[model samples]
Structures are given as structure tokens and as C-alpha cells.
Target: MASREFLKILSSARLGDVSAQQKLADAYLTGAYKTPIQPANALIWLEKSYFSITNQALEGASSGSTQISELIAQTANIPLAETFGSPAFGFGWNSFWGLAQSSIESDSRSAAQWQLVNLLINPINQDIQKQLSEWIKKNATSLEKVSDLDLGALQKLAKQFLNELSESNSSFATNAKELLIKLQPKNEALSSLWKVWQEDQNEEALTQAAELGLTAAKLILGLRLAQLDGNTETKSNASLKKAAYWLELAAKDGDRDAWYALGEIYRRPQFSGYNAAESDRCFDRAADLGHAQAQLRKGASLWRKREKTEEKIRGLQASYWVWQAHQQGIAEAKELLNKILDSCPDPKKNDWYELAQFAEQALNHHAEHKLDEDWLLLSHRIIIANQFNFSKAELLLCEVGQLQHEHCVAVDIRWELPKILPRLIQIESIQQRRALLAAGKVFAAADLEIEGNLRQRRYRFDQVTSWLVTTFFKDQTESAIN
Candidate 1:
């Protein structure tokens, strides 16, 4: 749902309010809540904006006429090619031609309009270019004998030629539409600039292409500008600002590299706009987009939160991100992941409480007390421990069967012992895999109290062990329980 403010602005725009229309156009370009970025819709509103202004200016001299004229002049000041480009008006060649044909009567900015049309429609048609240029030149000149060119006749011929093209729209319009659809965003202006830059590494062409709303050009231009060093602090700051501007534009277009670059800029202490929060957000966006460096950074940052008691749960999260980065071929991530794994207690080195003596006695005790869920759970745990070689801590604290991956089991005892990080143990044999599957079924139906705090679980284990040793293992029971 849109807010009341947006609704009011929308109402005003629909009622032909130029300011409101321009605002809506910018909103569509940049995107806002309930309005995703739509370049085509932005262009349509911008076109309607100028058209409304033009109409107002033509109506008569009024208090708003001066303001309207100023806006028209400002729009007119932009180079015709750029004005029609996707970055400016988001108009395709067909759209521009349609505008030119419809606006012939007003003739407010006919020369520029026709010039853009000529440039966009048929750059290969030299005859049309030469004719339009000569015709425009003659019309702009007011001399009685302007270099032997008849201004009125040339104007008539130009209008007649434009009318003829407009009449032949079926052939040209359909072709232009098809081509535009094929060339996404349909801005030939930027495509030409790409060639211009590639020819001589022209920065000017790159800048133009960036201005024409090419995401790649914006990213390249932003990166090039970001690398620049100025003679003074002021100049350096200015350069950073320019780089940020272009990078932000690209970031808004969902460029991951641009987002990462913006993150670096915001994180820089030397940059005046240094903002740690904003930098974190930018890096988060980049990481979400699968930027390897950002993922590594995010993982390392998460790992740093382990000191906080509440952040222990994030240890697995940190490992997950680091693992993601490692899979993406980041060398540092592999080292960090190794370090995290090394911090975990190896189950093989852990104390063994469910040994053969204890296990056989526990099985006999469980058989005698078949209705006891605790004994049943303990039996399942013993079976798991003997088969998979899990330690007493893992057998007691681990979420059996549920934590099984395809080829490995995730033994997480963090719920009882937050210090003992989770580790994945591989299922090396068919026997081990079957044991795990069987354990999963038994545990799934077991009592929830089977998984309790360290103290409660340790007490339960000791109580069961004491009872089993005394009743089933009388010979060993003579030796006091350890």
C-alpha cells in the first residue's frame, strides 16, 4: 500500500502537475516503496512532464510561464542525442520518431527533435543526414539571402519529408520496435560510446556512456575515478564523491561489483563520507550477491562475535559463510575454516564413557526395563556410539539422525556445551550409514527430555550407569563406581 503522501503526489501527477510528474518519474527511475525501478515508465512520465511544461508555456504569458520556459530551456540545453538516450528520456528510436511527428505543429524544439530523429533513425543514410542538416541550418538563419538557401522552401520540404516518414511508419516502426526489443534498453547512444571508448580508450566516451545509463559503463567509470589520486585533500575528497555518485547509480541497478566498491569507499577514513554502518550494509548486499571477498569478510566478522554469549549460535553461521567463500576458491577462507574446525574437540580424543563393559550392561538393563523411554534412548545412544565411534558428550548431546547430511553427520553439542563447536563427521561405510538411519528413527520417537542441559543429562547418564552396574554387572559393581 502506498502512503497518503505518495497517493497525493500520484493524484497531482495524473491531473497534469509537472512537478509531481517529474517526482514520480524520478521515483520510478530510482525505485521507492511499492514502486520498483522501471526505466521505461520513468521515461514516459518524464516525456509527459516536458510536454505539460511545453503546453503551459504555449498557453500564454503567466506567472508560471517563466518557470516553465526555464525548464524547457534546461531540457533543450542537453545534447539532442543524449536527451533521447535511455539515460535521459529512455526513448527508443521509434518513440523519438513518434514524438517528432506529433509535435511538428508546436515546433517548439523542432530542430533538436528532428536532429535526434535523423541521428537515431538512419545514421547509415548519409543523404537524409545531409538534407536534414542543411534544412535545419537554413531555417535557423534569418538573412534575406542565406547562402543561396531558401529558408521557407527548405522548411516546407523538411516538414513534407518528416510527414512522408511518419506515413511510412508501418515498415520502419515495426522494424525499429523489433530491433529495440532485441537490443535491451534500446540505447544506441551508449552502444556507439562503447565503440568510441574501445577505439582510443576515450574517457569522454566512457563518461557519456555512463551518463547514458549503461550499468557496465557506470561501473567502469566509477572504478577508474575511484583509482584517481589528487594533489590535495580537497581534490581527493571531490574525486571520491564523484566515484561514489557513479558507483551508487550502478549499485541501484543491482551491480554487485558496484556495491562492493561503494562499500570500500564508505569504509575509507580518508573519504569525507566515511560511514561504517553504510559500508557494512553495502558489503552485506555484495556478499548476498555472492561477492567472495565480502563473504570472507562477513564470515570473519561473524566469527568475531563468538566472545558474546548470545552469539555462540552464530558460530555455525560464520562457518557456513566461510565454507561458502572457501567453495568459491578463496584461499584465506580455507585456512580460517581449518582454524575454526581445529578449535572443536575431536570426538576420537574425547573421553569414552559408553565403553563395551558399560554398553553390554546397559543393553541388558534396557531389555529388562523395555517400557523405560530413558533406557531406550540410552540404548540408541550406545548403539550410535559403538557404530559411529562418537564420544560420550556427542552421544548424549547430539541430535541423532536429524543432523545427518547425505555423506556425513553434523554433531552439534553446542546446546549443552556452547564452547564445543559443531563438527561434521563423514559416514565412511554402508554399516555406519544404516546405523545412522536406524538411530534417526529411534530418536525421532524418543522423549524430548533425552536432549537436555549438560547437568541434567550428565546426572541421568550417571544414574542409569550406576543402576546398570549394580544390577547387571555385579562383579564390576563390587569396584566402586568411578
Candidate 2:
């Protein structure tokens, strides 16, 4: 059943009220007032509203012109996937144009005229097509002059606009040049090159695309170059260098596979420029970007072989990365994560009450100087400690971001207190997760200088804890007695 408001709008729309028609269209578009979101119905009412508005404009009064135009733009911009649904559906633009042609008066085609002006002239819609429209509007002459403007490969809206423009303007040629000098990487030539490479196994086309600065092409080219010299024992330094150059280019563009491939290239012992540290860094980058193999590799590297206590510490730190890989369906990661968790099973939950209270007082006291005074970090550590049950040593030494995991938090304080073992703490509640998220925010914003070395952190913790206990707690106790 329609709401009273919707019924009223629908009744007014039936009576040829333009504003009511637009409101009815909006109600259908967004399912407002319990109306079903039917794109086909929405377009129907929008067409009715357009015809009514154009009729009114012809009669020398236009009230809802801007509102209707903006609504049409919004509807036009909706993804075609969402627009095409059951009870009578077509492309949004097609339906819009089809109904628009109903007006007998050529000048009364204001809504259709507005759409073309918006698409070709003002270009208000902020999407890929709009961007292409802006480029085409400015480069109309240039587009006509260009030799290979892959019109077919252009986005649907852009292709339609170009075709219409060419039909309307006698000077505008169908054959045109490249229009993607500004759009980089996602051009017609790159798409064509990719298609040719995939179908014909043309390395030359692949090379051309790579030279055109496509990150995917660069990564593929690098991998192919490296594959040709599969055995590192016989691989020439020149071949490895060539592959590394392209991989490095792609890695700089934040391609995960490129980073992982670069890591592998660096790990090859026979490579002239082999660097274990650089290899680890590349793997770390790839792991950070959610690459499964890199995550597993990084996790395995973090897990140190040692005494049971040290193993727990290392395991906690390694578990997060391993678990990440496991979530991505890596069998080896699942096994490794399970083994680590088995060794460093969740300890009995113990929170620091006095420390938590002291942190709160210190936080309020140094509210203005949280970042510069390091009170914010102390507060974050206290929150982490209370929720994850971190030891004082762990709280002082652990890096906040590294320990954060989806299911649990990792705790490793061996950097400052080698005797104190690392531990994995399970996050068992929504409250704990929220606390971790909030604390993580503080650590993310804190400066490296303020976070300090383990020694400085321990010293600050000692100083602050001692001062808060002596002064703040004594004052509170005295007040309570009074």
C-alpha cells in the first residue's frame, strides 16, 4: 500500500502536475514512502514529467525545470545494471530519448536538449564518461584529425556522444586520432594490444602496451622476461636486470604481483644484485597489499626458532600475517597459523586496573599535549593492555599496528625486555574489537619521534605511572575519605 503522501503525488501526477510527476518518479527511483524501487516505472514517470515540463515551458512558465533536469541527470548516471529490471526495462538513455521524442514542438524538447547540453557542453556527471566527454568537447577538432580514435572501444556514453556529434556536425569526421593522452593506461590501443597479445600470443603488442605505461602490461612483461631465464644458475645478469626494471616500475605503481615477483627476483642467489633485505622488503610490501604467497613468506620469516617462551613471542607476531594468508585459502598458511596458535594458546585474561585508571587521569591531564607529551600513546597502550591483557613490558615495547589482527591481537615485547615472552590475545567481544580499533587510531596518528625507542617508552611509562599513583591516586583517596 502506498503512503498517503505517495498516493497524493501519484494522483497529482495522473492529473498532469509536473512537480508531482517528478516526486512520483523520485519515489520509484529510491523506494521513498514504501514505494518499490522500480527503475522502469521511475523512467516512465520521469518521461511524463519531462513532457509536462516542456508543455509548461511552451505555455511561458517553467517552475520545476532545475529540479527535473538534476533528477534526470541523476537517473541517467545510475549504472545500467541497476536500471534494467523486470516489468518493462530498457537502457536509461534509450528510454529517456525515446520518450523525449514525443513532444511535437521542437523547442519544447527542453529536457532532451538539457541532457545533450549537459553531456556535451557542461559535463556535470562525475564519472568516466563525463571525463571522456570533457576531453572530447575540448578536443573535438583534435579527435577529428587523429588517425586511430578507437570509437568502438570507448565507453557506451562517450561512443554514443561521438557518433551523434559526428552525425550533427558535417565538419566532424568519423575517423579520428587518439583521445587518451590525458587518460593514461586505459586507452583503445592498450585494450587492442592486450586483446592481440592474448589471442595471437604477440610479445611485440605486449611490449608496445608496456611501453604505453600500463601497469598490468609492465608486470606481465617483467614476468615473461624473468620466465624466459627460468633457472637462476644460468640466468644472465642482463636478463634479470631487464625484468627487475619493469617489475620495479609496476611495483612503484602499487601492483601486488609486481612486488611479489620483484621479491622472487631479488631472492634468486645467482642474480648479480641479490639483496635479502630488499627481497624481504618487497615481500612485506606485497603482503601488506594482501598477496597470499607474500603474506605466508612474511609470516614464516617473522616466526623465529627458539625456546618455548621466545617461540610464543615470535608466533604471536607471525600469526596475524599467516592468518591473513589463511583467509585467502592458502593451505600452508592455515597449517602455520594453527601451529603457532597451538603453541601460544590464549593465556588467562588479566587486565591492569590501576594502570587503566592512571592512564585515564593522565589522558585528561595532558589532553592538549596528547601527541607531543606522549599521553595519547600511554592511553592507547592502557586500552590495549586492559582489552588484550598486555603485560607492562609488552605495553611499553610492542608496535601497535603490527599486533592488530582480525580475530586477535599479537604481543611481542622482546625488543625491550627479552626475558618477557610474546603472547597472542584473543579478542572475544565487540567491546574488545571496538577498543582495539579506537586505540589503533591513536597509534596510527602518533609521530615516530614521540613513540620513541623501547628504552624511552619504558622510562616514560615508569615516570608517568609513578607520578599518577603518588599524586592523582592520593588526591582521589583523600577526597573519598572526606
Residue 299's C-alpha lDDT in candidate 2? 84
lDDT of 2 by residue, 1-482 (tens): 87666787899999998778877877787666668877668777776777787777778885657755555554553333333332322335443443234444332233343343343333234353434445444445533322333333334444444444333422221121012212244778889998998899788998998998887789888987887425455353347888999999877665778899999999898789999999999999898767999998988887753334454455665777887888899998867776677332222245566667666666556644343448577777776676666667777777887876775777776666778766666555766665566566567867757767877887888876777688678978998999
Q: How many residue pairs clash per model? A: 0, 4
CA deviation > 4 Å runs, candidate 2: 1-183, 228-238, 305-314, 342-407, 410-422, 428-482
Total clashes in model 2, counting residue pairs 3 or more apart in sequence or in different chains? 4
lDDT of 1 by residue, 1-482 (tens): 67454577789999999888877866675454346666556666666776786787678636555664444433332334433325434333224333344544433345334544445343354454455455445445432212334434544444444444343433332333222223336367878898999798788999998898878888888877787323233233347889999999877665778889999999888899999999999998788767898988888988887677364234666776777788799999978877564332233433443343465555545545663776667656765666556777887878775666653456788776888866755445655564565567567767766456777877877876677666656657566675
TM-score of each: 0.43, 0.39
The TM-score, computed over Cα atoms with residue i paired to residue i, of candidate 1 is: 0.43
State which candidate has the highest TM-score: 1
Please list all clashing residue pairs in model 2, or write none if there are none.
146-176, 146-177, 147-177, 313-422
Best by lDDT: 2
